[model samples]
Target: MCTYLKNMEGYKLKDLKLKEFDSIQEMFDRAFKRQKVKDDKETTELKQLMKIILDEEEVEIDVIPLAVKSPSIIGWKIRKEGRKSYYQIIRADGKSQTYMIFSHMLKSFDREDLENLYELVKAKYESTRPVEDLDLILWGDLKTMFEPHIEDKVWKNQQDYKVLNWKLYDSCGVHSLRMQHVQIYMLVEKKYPLTPSTLTMMLEKKLMIDYESEMAYQLLKFIMK
Candidate 1:
């Protein structure tokens, strides 16, 4: 039993006697049944949606270039917390926008697969030769979210990357009604340790700094009311 427990990654079976094994087995059996039912339901729903889309009279299928049709994995960042590891892959839409996919508890990656992905991004970057002509935008990291601001202000002011745009996303400007407000609320909720009221105050100040005082006040009054 000691050897068996030691073989486990971080779990201990010493406290779990043979009597508890039956209960654990039963619980896993029930969970498996529940998952199968849920998967079947989702499969049926997807089939129905696919049928409807295929049978629609006015539905159109416009062919796009192969390059534009596929999502490109440009870069990645790896993070480790204790024994768990996470992989955040940066994906570009072959257009101007980029987003991140945060993977949970990734077990491992094939060396050849990673090499291929790196080469793909490198090729894309090289295609736009004469480096000075290439333009790119990288989003801020959630970990060191604001340290760049202090560094930029103190020493790199002249070379600082200007706030080309803000409010959730640069491309999502103006077209998304009330989305910027929702984004601010979500950002505060996810990234900051603040209550709703405090977040509102912080957002108001941030907007004011961006010369959006009127919008800031309106948001505060509306949300607080």
Candidate 2:
């Protein structure tokens, strides 16, 4: 097992004082109880979809509603006595439905595994792109632009510099750098509506990377521009 997972083995939801609802509706009700506007049709439909997916997958999950500005539901699944945790989110806008299972646990990954994962994420991102946007700048574009300026060969020596950046930044925070990357891309393209929480979900489950040591700070700097 991964060291991170091992460290989390003793943790439990109840230990955090998190109350799990028996059904998704109950969870939503609790989440929106204080709000003047209740859960809308889009949010309801998305919750139903999440329930179906969980049932079909036979996943044992604890449905927890988030108390954020946007209406969303999160399903948490624990396996092997908290040795593994999976988080799945469904948003009202329907653009951010995805599962973040084990990919967040990157401490156990070797260089080759990280490379393969990076390639997989790149291919998936490319496949989802619009035909007209195929040539647009990507994580690789940023990496290529910055590689020659980097003095340390350790960053360049990796099979894919993008993966190296992801490793370093993910180690810093769960999805900090990737979220900033998405924010920058959205700023540059003037598209893709994003919020801090939704962008984090996309990074963990959908949106997928750059650099060596300074990438996260560089991403922050880019956003400041």
TM-score of each prediction: 0.19, 0.20
Candidates' C-alpha lDDT: 0.32, 0.32
**In every candidate, how many clashes are there?**
0, 0
Encode model 2's per-residue lDDT on 1-225: one tens digit a residue.
Answer: 233322333444464356444543354444454232333553343332121111122322443433434343222122233544343334444422223333332322233333443354355555565222212333343233222233333323332212211123233222322322231212121222233444344333421232222333433333323
Candidate 2 overall Cα lDDT vs. reference?
Answer: 0.32
* Candidate RMSDs in order: 18.2, 22.3
Model 2 segments beyond 4 Å from truth? 1-100, 110-112, 118-213
- What TM-score does structure 1 among the candidates reach? 0.19
